[model samples]
Target: MRTILYLMILGLGMSCSNTSKKNDGIEMDSEIKDTVTTESLSTSRMEADLKKKGYQTFSYKAGDTTYLMQQYYMVFLKSGPERSQDSTEAAELQKQHLAHLTRLYEEGYTSLTGPMGDDGDLRGIVVFNTATQKEADSLANLDPMVKAGRLVVEVHPWWVAKGGKLK
Candidate 1:
């Protein structure tokens, strides 16, 4: 009687374990299907949105590779902590710096300019609508911040969509 009881318990435990494994496999399959469905939905939505925006699918791409539409200048701003005499001077220089940037924008020299968030060593970036690095460098040096030694700029050539023209 004892041997029979032990065999019955072992069989019952094995059956339960097999059922649990089957349920887990079913759950995993469901999760995989959900993930695939979500990814396909996201991809289709992105393609539709791009079409709605009047952008041609192949305009910036060559097969699987993407290419720049035009060449422009990118200026990276770096902090110059030792250049300021005091806080007031730094503030004043910053004010002048903004004005200088506005002037450049109005003159069609700077296409875009913005400050980076307080996260890294990069202070800001200025995009210039120029074909050569020398011209961009000269223009960037005109900023009051650069003149006051409160900031320094490094210029590089960047190529992107020609559609990125400033209004």
Candidate 2:
């Protein structure tokens, strides 16, 4: 019976891992966050080298470059203790900002990018279908992190697979 109880508790914990968020004035909590930083100097060099193999790289904007194997949005968020600011106001601000992101996710914007900050703050990345820079910019406007000064959004184009042109 004890073993069964432990198993039940473990299952409950896993099931409750789903994060909750608020959109505009609506609250939601169904999206599990994904945090992966796919950008590194080695990754960048590999991406650049891929172009030489006839894999084309294109700019989402006139000067912007996307180096990921696929397209995604990077997002960052920060709070008081992790931010080392001792500012409750900052924490409150971040919550409201995350709420905005919750709204976007609710609206079906799933490709995400980032480990939001330099330290213990919540950070993660999500990948999705390719979107234009203009589209990204529009997303930025609605993004809670961006609005809260907790995130910076960049539209990066990338190849969908090894040895393939950026889609």
Candidate 3:
């Protein structure tokens, strides 16, 4: 009985910790959004910055997958605390955002898709079967997050390993 009680407490503590971390991101994101009180930056400008950084971008032609050709479609999302704190709404939004991913998975357009939130930013990634970067583009367009401004979409090339590949 004592062991069970201790384990239960541990689980509850872990849950609380996770919730706190998630909320922290939401709060921080809100602060960041407020900081950018100037005219909202344009999407094109964001894309330009990524280009300057030489981020892996979508390319049909095979390059150096090992050297740097590895490609993956990605979207970096900046969200406010208001949206982040509302997990119920967030889940709904996630469903809408992943709709295309769900479809593509069945269609075998790619292997896996997921959204990762960290440091007041959300990053979404989708693995593809081959160099066909179109799959990522098509699905990214479908994500409601991209459509809504909760996230920004940037399609890129990615290399896959056995662990990396979903299937």
Candidate 4:
């Protein structure tokens, strides 16, 4: 049929358009056999790339399907000029706060924690490994800075890849 011939021509044109140039500046043949060869070569190249990045082939089975353990929490602490305590009192509270955070880090309750470089109203962030936002909030509230009303925190539930853990 004429319609079938037209469709075949369109398909051929699309396939020809898909022909790409390789990194070596060579134009590969637009044939099925050439594509199969390229794919096999690509698989080996991919394995080499993964190896270069220190990736290893492995598998594990926990026998548990729960995903709550994978959940993380973040606290965005906003800096404010209005404080219930004086400047000297607030400085003392901040010192105690830093020590408190150090203790939490040693205990593995917090993973990545640090203050922002700028002196903006948005001060710092604390990434917590707790299972729930409530738990993370309770821990954040335990800080002397937050208790003295020098820093306010907005807690948020953070979802990240399980393998993307830094520690």
List the RMSD of every prediction in angstroms.
15.0, 19.6, 20.6, 15.0
| RMSD from true fold, candidate 1 | 15.0
TM-score of 4: 0.55
Model 2 over residues 3-107: C-alpha lDDT tens digits?
Answer: 999999998997666544457543324342212123344456776775564444443322222334544444333332223334786677667766766666667
User: In candidate 1, what are the lDDT values of residues 7-111, reduced to their tens digit?
Assistant: 999998975554324543433355455665675565556546655654333234454333335457899988765574688988888898999999989998888
TM-score of each: 0.56, 0.37, 0.41, 0.55
- Model 2, stretches more than 4 Å misplaced? 1-86, 112-130, 161-167
Superposed model 4: Cα runs more than 4 Å off? 1-69, 165-167
Worst 10 residues of 4 by lDDT: 60-69
Where is model 2 poorest over a 10-residue stretch in terms of lDDT? 30-39
Q: Model 3 off-target regions past 4 Å?
A: 1-91, 117-119, 161-167
lDDT tens string, model 3, 1-167?
99999999999896555432354353234444444432133333533554575534322223212111334444334453344536777788878766766877788666666666555465656665433466556666666766655666566665432223234
Give the whole-model CA lDDT for all candidates, comma-separated.
0.73, 0.50, 0.53, 0.73
Best by TM-score: 1
For residue 102, model 3's alpha carbon misses the true position, in angstroms, by 1.9
TM-score (C-alpha, index-matched) for candidate 3 = 0.41
Cα displacement (angstroms), candidate 2, residue 95, comes to 1.3
